[model samples]
Target: MKLIIRWLLLACALVLLTQLDSGIQIRSFGSAMWAAFVIGLLNAFVRPLLILFTLPVTVLTMGLFLFVINALTFQMASHLLEGFQVQGFWHALLGSVLYSVCSLVIDVALERLLGPRFMPPPQ
Candidate 1:
């Protein structure tokens, strides 16, 4: 199913991130997968709330404050999950950027390969 594929891609992205960043670590693929799921849930539920609360700053910064929000969410995920670590704020920022880029690329590739059915219509 699409959900499983998305989860696997996210796990792969996390694994790739660990290899690229010494400050980010994952104990195993299983841990990476779990971290990916947690991260997704956090992004889905917590990110919107954080954005809502930070609207003033986000608006003042022309939305650039979203980077900080994303990094904080990523760091929070590291704290909540076992066997996954983000060393510092800088690392968390870089890891969040990397995660977004990788996930975007993978999703685009899947959409292309699987046709329109693989991706939802853009709003």
Candidate 2:
């Protein structure tokens, strides 16, 4: 239930991002949902690989390069979908930043609402 709620909220955030002229456009709620799901999958699967491959750069940049990895994941999602459009690399970079911020806010809100039971155990 919490997962579903988070997913829907993230989709809504994506829609709101399009309104901000973030250069990311979503054709419909369904598309936004798909985009959110794709992004999640990419983050779960691709992001780790990217981080590993760019470990040296990430270390050199003191983790700032993670933002570029996030942008690449965002752009990859846009390319895989028809209704989700990102203007270019820069647009993806901005969209990824916004999306990450929104997701963090949503997670915090959910944590407060649902309690720690739904959150992961501390590493």
Which window of 10 residues has the lowest lDDT sum in candidate 1?
A: 113-122
Q: lDDT per model, in order?
A: 0.93, 0.95
Per-model TM against the reference:
0.92, 0.93
Model 2 per-residue lDDT tens digits across residues 10-45: 999999999986589999999999999999999999
Off by over 4 Å in 1: 117-123
Judged by lDDT against the true structure, how good is candidate 1? 0.93
lDDT of 1 at 56: 99
Residue range 7-78, candidate 1, lDDT tens digits:
899999999999899999999999999999999999999999999999999999999999999999999999
lDDT of 2 at 12: 98
- What's the CA error at residue 76 for candidate 1, in Å? 0.7
> Considering summed lDDT, which 10 consecutive residues are worst modelled in model 2?
113-122
